[model samples]
Target: MIEEARIKKNLKQFTFPRLSGTDYEIKAYKKLTKEVENLNLKYKVQFFTFSSFYSRIYPKIGFSSVSIILFLFYLNIHMSISIILILILFTILIISIILTRKPEKIQFITKMDSQNVLVKIKSLSKEKKNYDRIALFISHLDSKGQRFTIKIRIRIFKLWITSSISLTATIISKNSILRGFELIFYIIGLFPLIFNLLSTIMMLLNTTDNSSDGAVDNASGIACNLELLNHYSIPENRLIIIYGFFLLELKNAEQWVLDIFIII
Candidate 1:
């Protein structure tokens, strides 16, 4: 049977200023460790850093958009080889930036150290398969604060529509310099630029207003994971069950035990 009381205790203990890399997240990690230890369960803790405050792709698109915007500011309505060269440069920039966007590019300003709590229970049942297997019960201990919701999704769809039109217009327009390549560059880069720019604005707002209590979003998942650990045991011979508590999941930073899970 699942223990609802542990869920409440976790929710109560999770009530803190958990902004990814801040002291709040650290405290939460500590609390998680304590909980597992109280169960007399052996676990491992792995720490990692990620770009929580500022995303790398946001600024890349922003710079590309601003550059195209400025180039169009003084552009003339004429076709020229220079316009083609500009397109090539912009394409190269965008592609290279996207390719190089690894975890290391995370901004140094707010690069945060987050923890993953991992618990493994060997299966008790006999294995029928020829190969060893593992199963993961994944959950996140942190919550996210979002200031923008469906409005942003609607806007993104609108931007994509306009951007498609803009790209098509570039192909048919007579003046390749003024309207074709120039507008296409602006539209392509501006998509992410505008979206992330608005996201940044909402993030700024969320920074001041702490209205997000993400109990149902992910605290419930963690609570269920803990309950499984507390009340039940997996069939060891069938599979090795691994429970992982991920941080910065909302930030697209779940790279840690994933490789191990995939390899085995």
Candidate 2:
């Protein structure tokens, strides 16, 4: 039976932010593990430690740097060779940043350990071959915070999108006059760049100051994953079901889920 009341009760146990690689994150992981045990299921906790830079810090630095680069690109149309050299460096910096942002890429200097709880359900049929296929379900347990309110976030996204277009226009535009005109979008983008600066600062802040309890951000997702598992049973010799609760979903630092899938 999938008891909504029980799920709600469990969620209440951890109402604070679960920052990636933080103590609170481990507590939540333990709590969830306890629940899995209560259900009389077999599970394993894969403890793996990985160290990386504060995820938000570098990305924010990257964003602010790119924003400056865009502004510089617009302003340096007729600048000297020295200015051009600086622009080249900034461009290379941006490229390097983009490479490091993905989940699979490990470019940070600091490493931290994260846990993934794996629950496996096997088919009960006499023949193991009867259940040939495997189904996997995943959910992340962590939350994040940002500087701008929801309202401002929309405007920020719009600004970012417009900035991309503006940058593209300037890059491809052959005429100086037209390129100058396209620079307006980039100018408008400056407003969000200011917001980006605020975001960068917020990113560097600890989860206590910058992260939220994240009820809607990801609590609901975890709850749903729990509920779905509770509501169903694995058939014997017909299916194998695996449930993985991955830690550290904040700031794009988690790729442990992918690694888990490969292991499965």
Candidate 3:
């Protein structure tokens, strides 16, 4: 049955990391559209833009800051011990703020062709008065795979623990010296967040295929969608299934979704 086919197609669509603008994503969209059309369902193929998951800005910033800090530390100025301590304390505070300001990952979006994409989709159902709105099936189509070496993983974990401890110290320590140290720790903690953001940006710009077929990352998700369509009989209500391929390097999901709808 057509319903069965839709379910199968959904499965395929979700079987890979559907990074925005990737070949796999494009192909999957095309296949989904064709299947929907075959079922005599009126559908639209919307496009959107999102931040790339492999940006390099954050990492670059972290490394650059570290280098600068090291260079400054090496230039042993003739300051009194008290002055040196004060400087270190200030530096720690700055570092903490920087870390806290690091942007979030998974902040990409699809561009829709219209400012009122949601409205348009809603209209489709509204025009067919017989069709009631049933459920909104939302799923993201993307894949994330990190080829972290053992050394890198260990280093990352260590840094993460250190960052957490430093943050806790900052919160709990009342002594001015401890507070200063906490500030520095906070800044250092930000390095990882920045690095991640930069990597995400890079991913958006590159054609690198980091995933191995993205089977579990997303193919499984698509498969699940298809299965749902197949198993569930057509309801009197309209089904709104959203296949989203977002850039995972950004920080705002709601904003990204709004942007996608605007493009649609």
On residues 152-261, what C-alpha lDDT tens digit does candidate 2 reach at each position? 65665565556556554654452354554655655654564455445444434422333678787677767766765665443423245677777653333244334333
lDDT of 1 by residue, 191-242 (tens): 5445544543443443322345667757677777777777644243235677
Local distance difference test values of all predictions, in order? 0.59, 0.61, 0.43
- Rate residue 25 of model 2 by lDDT: 81
Candidate number that wins on TM-score, 1 or 2 = 2
TM-score of each prediction = 0.64, 0.70, 0.46
**Best model per lDDT:** 2
RMSD of each: 6.4, 5.4, 9.6
Clashes of 1: 7
Identify the superior model by lDDT, candidate 2 or candidate 3: 2
Q: Comparing 1 and 3 by lDDT, which wins? A: 1
Candidate 1 stretches with Cα past 4 Å from truth are: 15-17, 52-101, 104-109, 126-131, 153-157, 160-171, 174-211, 233-239, 250-264
Span of ten consecutive residues with least summed lDDT in model 3: 112-121
Poorest 10 consecutive residues by lDDT, candidate 2: 255-264
